[model samples]
Target: MADGEEVTLDGRPLHLLRVADLKAALESRGLAKSGQKSALVKRLRGALMLENLQKHSTPHATFQPNSQIGEEMSQNSFIKQYLEKQQELLQQRLEREAREAAELEGAFGAKSGDFGNLSHLEGIWVKFRRIWVI
Candidate 1:
């Protein structure tokens, strides 16, 4: 934000960039690539600062709401209503998903039932199935 101030592009300090990366950036900007890492960082920073300045030169549009107290109160009420509606919808969706999951588990016996518990006397059910085809 100031002269000679280092900015990070990807969490790593700009001055700590690899020599090859610094050279690549310099080359891209059509700057001299024969300099040391510090010189490269300086050049890149200068180029980036100029670019930032150019970006800020453009005029930006800003929101201008009604200054009247009644209109401001209406805008606030509208925002509150929208947010409350979204929250209620989210709560309803969560409740419905939970209920559907519970119904599925009950219908499928996923949580409470286990086939291993309904055992016969030491493989009696297997024998019964073989003999009693009906």
Candidate 2:
């Protein structure tokens, strides 16, 4: 299969891998397998892509110069496509991470005057504070 190409099971995509098989693969890779099919597919794809990246290094030296314009063009196009896919994947990952970070910040961000145990009394406390206590 070409680089970045997804693996298929039973003519369907990798997501079609049965739950048992997917769990086995995840456990073998030391990953948590407690999610749904979509999550499993995502984890497996990321693991597979990471493995593929580790296996393949720079492809520049692998190309054999061909005198035919068509052959050279095809190889160049393939390389360009592969690089573009990798770039797209990286961009997507960056966006996902940024979104998660923003969510985490939103979850943990509390204003300075926010109360923890007496949250329900926040506005009441502000309204009933001593009038002369500056």
Candidate 3:
């Protein structure tokens, strides 16, 4: 497998493991090992996905609180921070897109009235017609 490729729970690269290796890996995880090769691959992928979700979903020890109110407050703060960061990123992206659109319009001569004038359009049509005639 490639270096950037994802691995299984046992650190073995996915899509490169043989049938026996798959069975062994499933057995090690106490998962069902009885299935066809495709089924085995699907089961292993599902296990890997579930493991990743569980790892990411678990809160850090520092975030854990003894009191329920304290935990709720901490969670609320985290959520607010996350939302603000997302909104800032979105605003930056929108501004970048608007700048790019303006640049494209300038490059295509749209700001110089090249597209707004009928004479320029007729010149473009004449050039296009000449190209087809040749």
Candidate 4:
């Protein structure tokens, strides 16, 4: 609903609706890519579909290996385990991204790549504006 435009669905924003609308939208896209299984798509599609529920502009949502997410964070055993694993993965990724960002910063100080330091995301628009030209 952001970065991309949103359209009115029956006089209301499409995002105001339920998971059903999301399912329909995704299904309407057709053709599944090769090498990926349906189960993975089903869960991912479900989470993205659920994102329509968020009122906030920024995407605070992330995927758990087992599907159900964020506000719908599941209490199911498998989902719980998956969520814990995902937290660990997120921590590791944050650490890695921070390290990579530091390395990139040292190399060019944001004069080169988009992958540079981002301790303050405030300058993202400035960087992105520059980045988007290429």
Candidate 5:
């Protein structure tokens, strides 16, 4: 089929599709792609028909309060809340780490330190080594 053309499950457009195009469409819909052109066409048609039926079908199941489903919904809500709390804790930890890093940088006089000077780096390394070694 041509690009930008509306794909129809109708017999004409489906029949016009090349084997490769048919296989591609089948593969896209997670349908079995290993088949002859005619078989592929039939499979695609069935899938499209089923999909159309599902879209048109009305809901058979209705939500009932104070049921097992309600308990499941509450459990899902609890999980969501727990995940949000974990995310908040993670954010706080990241902020703490950033603050500590900034304090370390300040102690090293990083903003004003002469990074181009080898002697300055050597002095900082010596201080770092002394603190760690002790």
Candidate 6:
């Protein structure tokens, strides 16, 4: 965001792209303990995420309408992109579950009505995700 400030490409912000650049940056500053260094990296990553999130707005589905007070913006390219990315993520999750279920078929041989405890039926899914989410 500022001169000499680092930006993240992956989950980590402090990853070294070029060894020379990393060496230069480190040599430019004093050192800390390895644990402290990792914590600093995490904090920097969190700050960058918040900064990036502020730039891109997403419309959230709400129980009580807030459009009256207008804190949430109307759906835009950002919201559309978020929905598309979410759909892709969900599709990948479904495919993973299908694969896992198929693998379990030989062992469990379960039918539609097989599971008694809803937890067993739900398998890998969390509680709120299974509740009226359909």
Clashes of each: 0, 0, 0, 0, 0, 0
Clashing pairs in 6: none
The Cα RMSD of model 1 versus the native structure comes to 20.3
What tens-digit string does per-residue lDDT give for candidate 5 at 44-86? 8778767876988887588655567535644686765765565
Shift in Å, residue 85, candidate 4: 0.7
Output the worst ten-in-a-row residue range by lDDT, candidate 6.
66-75
Error of 3 at 85 (Å): 49
In angstroms, how far off is 7's CA in candidate 5?
9.6
State the lDDT of candidate 1 residue by residue for 8-126, as single tens digits: 64567778889888888778889887778888888887887787788888655574455465455446867657655655565566566556666877898776334333332225545
Q: lDDT for model 4, on a 0 to 1 scale? A: 0.52
In model 5, the clashing pairs are: none
What is candidate 4's lDDT per residue for 61-87, written digit by digit as tens?
Answer: 684564434335444667667756755
TM agreement with the true structure for every prediction = 0.38, 0.37, 0.36, 0.28, 0.38, 0.30
Cα lDDT of candidate 1 equals: 0.65
What TM-score number comes out for model 6? 0.30
Alpha-carbon shift of residue 62 in model 2 (angstroms): 19
- Model 3: weakest 10-residue lDDT segment is 112-121
Q: After superposition, how far is residue 22 of candidate 5 from its true place, in Å?
A: 0.9
lDDT of each residue in 36-133, candidate 2, tens digit only = 98899888878876777778866676565764654554468676576556555655665665565556657989543343334333343444332211
TM-score for candidate 4, residues paired by index: 0.28
Descending-TM-score candidate ranking: 1, 5, 2, 3, 6, 4
